[model samples]
Target chain A: MTERVYAGRPRPGNNFELYSWFFMRISGLLLILLVIGHMVIMHIINNVDVIDYDFVAARWASIGWRAYDWLLLFLALLHGANGVRVVIDDYVRRKGWKVFTVAVLYTFTFILLILGSLVIITFEPIGMGS
Target chain B: MYRGGEGQLSFILHRITGVGILVFLFGHVADTFLVGFGPDLYNHAMAIYRLPVIRVLEVLLAAAVLYHALNGLRIIIIDFWPAASRYQRAMFYAVGVVFLALFIPAAITMIRPLFH
Candidate 1:
């Protein structure tokens, strides 16, 4: 068995690690529902070939679909980013490399989140018809 | 470093699934962005995803997500509810049961389209 390692000195109040750990669980549970629903709808029930511009546009035309997808995007990204951070903390022993890797991860995650949010939130299905 | 213990196995699988989902996110975002280009482009991209290889990959992805989500709940209970920590092994088994219960049906749904 891989022995659990506690790497850093314990921090004081407003425990970020505790919050993040909790967030992972909450977001993960939500994601299972959202992502699985999405996969079922897109790949199983509807089929990917049927999910064209109009299909997407029609789906997004409803606020419900937009909200569902937005929530899915937000939770999945945050959960995945935090999970990767924990993985980095666990394996990357060197301080400098750890910082560098984490920095890159944060930057990449931030950009993706921003771009994804923009696409989902600002989507205009009517524009696609033109 | 993993010795094939139940705990270690779950731990490793969680990381693998986490990474797998992240990778899929990249492609998903890119594909979704194709909507901005027009229906033809978006439909074309969606069409490519219908290929046999991608369908097979979807089954594996479903399994990974199921295990990760179920085991993740177990980890949460262990962390927050002190008493649950004592029965961690049992919880792990429970996670497996729930995972299979969900995943088997989902896998069937995902693969059934391929044969039709």
Candidate 2:
């Protein structure tokens, strides 16, 4: 008789990895919608040619668009960061190199997340009319 | 090199596209953040995006995003429904069909401006 391996549900003990795995799928489902919509509006419908400072200013002038962008920024950064972290864990074997790369990854992800959020939150519609 | 089947191919493509998009995202956020520097600097950066080469790259990026998104859905299905693995090969083809369907039109739209 062939042996049956225990490849069913994840066993208890590591809640963090379990949550991270769940986050990837959930965030991914949302991203397919969020990012595809973003592309259609920014790249297809509008095209880069039409997008300029004034265009952005006008868009951000509305709180709705700001909120939409802020959500996208937040989710995409976390999703991408976690995805890369998984990749690093899989391939980078050497202890020192792995630690260094992961450190850099976290550092950049943190900076970009903060920087993007600040831009969205603190944007002023300068010369865009109140 | 395991040299497996469709599953292997999908897994490899997922990694490649995910990394590519992440790298692009960092640059994109930095560029968009330039808006705070005022219009002159922002528009100057926007001009680079308008260049023909970057436009072509933009289409490639769209393809990457599309593939990653579709394949991601496939992964989810297989994860939630173990029965789905039996048909994963067919679903992989389905992902391809949907990718082409959506990507071709979007690619055309993005590239159309280059001729103008």
Candidate 3:
């Protein structure tokens, strides 16, 4: 027998909740590092004039930057989407609405993430095919 | 409708900021494409960004990017890592500490050069 002191029903497992909470802080710290690295290389290195289409082409030519950007894009979307999911749970009282909205949100988030990653990793910066 | 102390406020603010960043991202891409228009047009457009007002705006933009990105990381920490949830409040303050430590110095160094 368990003493029920709380008003609302308790969340089952709370696995998602636990992970979501941890993700925000960790990702935020990492974003600071990522953004600083990006800005230093892109902006402060040789001034903005050096960055042309050729510069972009040369940079993305490397797998290192591709992965860096991939990490950034996915982390950003997931972080933002999880925040949105929490908002839906907090405000949308109807159970059906909550499920529907979260599903749509996640779908969009993942689709964008996948598409962006593909473009970053496989992009041929010049007009011609590689 | 959100009350103080509720995590909901943070979520709402974050969504707004995220949307803002998305818009900013699109505008940035479009501006990059504008560079392809022509050298003269690109130079003129780039020149507009060098004005005093634009410089001020850039500073604000930098702060916005930093704040959103940093606070966002905080939200993630609280969401996924239950083991650290106990220290959420302390962790939030730690973010502020980190922000100030970097921001203050960066601002001073950035401005001093402009003045001298």
Candidate 4:
């Protein structure tokens, strides 16, 4: 009984929490590759200095890079959001505060997903047209 | 199992690094979104990243990422094979060694531009 002191009240649901746990592990594995590949390509091989407008334009010109980046953005945001949800559940015991914090987390995640997908999907290479 | 050991240290660091990466991810997405506004606006923003101080922070970010990813792997191993829980302390150190191996080279590359 004492061991469960820190565990948050388990809300009865359709295995939502179970799914969240599973998602973190799976997404973490995928991100290990996606993110490291991204870092190696952008930061090591090329360096930040070369990553400017034209560089982005050229890279996004390829559908493959666009798809890869879109997947990274999607997975990273959802994985991070769920991870924070667990943190909030653990620390924010106050009901109102927890609600507000989770609300903010969800709202931020939703807005960013939309904004990021828009940028990736609607991108037009410079010099092609306005 | 005890709170006064590597398990606790890994847990704390995991939470810290996860939150830190989330904050950075938010900023990264917002900044990347600026590419839609045009090159002048985007490159103007990229100027901030070229600062020497930001270069150092980039190295720290790399360290945080490597630590979090490696430690998360440790957690997954223990979860899937509970029998391996007995060796988690050793796994924690292993995670550290691998983190340093990968991070040192990446850190050097990340910060080398600052020296040049």
Task: Assess each model's interface with DockQ, reporting 2 decimals per model.
Answer: 0.41, 0.52, 0.20, 0.52
Give the per-residue lDDT of model 4 (tens digit) for B1-116.
44668878888899999999998999999999999998889999999999888988888888888898899888888776666777888999999899988988888888888877
Backbone clash count for every predicted candidate, in the order shown: 0, 0, 26, 0
* Candidate 4's iRMSD: 3.9
Q: Return the DockQ of model 2.
A: 0.52
Ten consecutive residues with minimal summed lDDT in candidate 4 chain A? A3-12
| Model 1 residue B12 CA deviation in Å | 1.3
- Stretch of 10 with least lDDT, candidate 3 chain B: B1-10
Candidate 2 structure quality by residue, lDDT tens digits, A1-130: 5332111123225889888888888999999999999999999889898899999999998999999998899889999999899899889999999999999999999999999988999988565553
Error of 2 at A54 (Å): 0.7
Rate residue A128 of model 1 by lDDT: 52
DockQ of 4: 0.52
Q: On residues B1-116, what C-alpha lDDT tens digit does candidate 1 reach at each position?
A: 33456767777778898888887886787778767766677778888778999888978887887787777777766655656655766777888888888778878877787888
Docking quality category of candidate 4 according to DockQ thresholds: medium
User: Considering DockQ, which of the candidate structures 1 and 2 is the better prediction for this target?
Assistant: 2
- Any runs in candidate 2 off by more than 4 Å, and if so which? A1-13, B1-3
- Encode model 4's per-residue lDDT on A90-120: one tens digit a residue: 8999999999999999999999999999999
Shift of residue A93 alpha carbon in model 1, Å = 2.1
Instruction: Write model 3 residue lDDT over B15-102, tens digit each, in one string.
Output: 6666555445444534544534444554566666556666555555556666676666665555455555556556656766877876
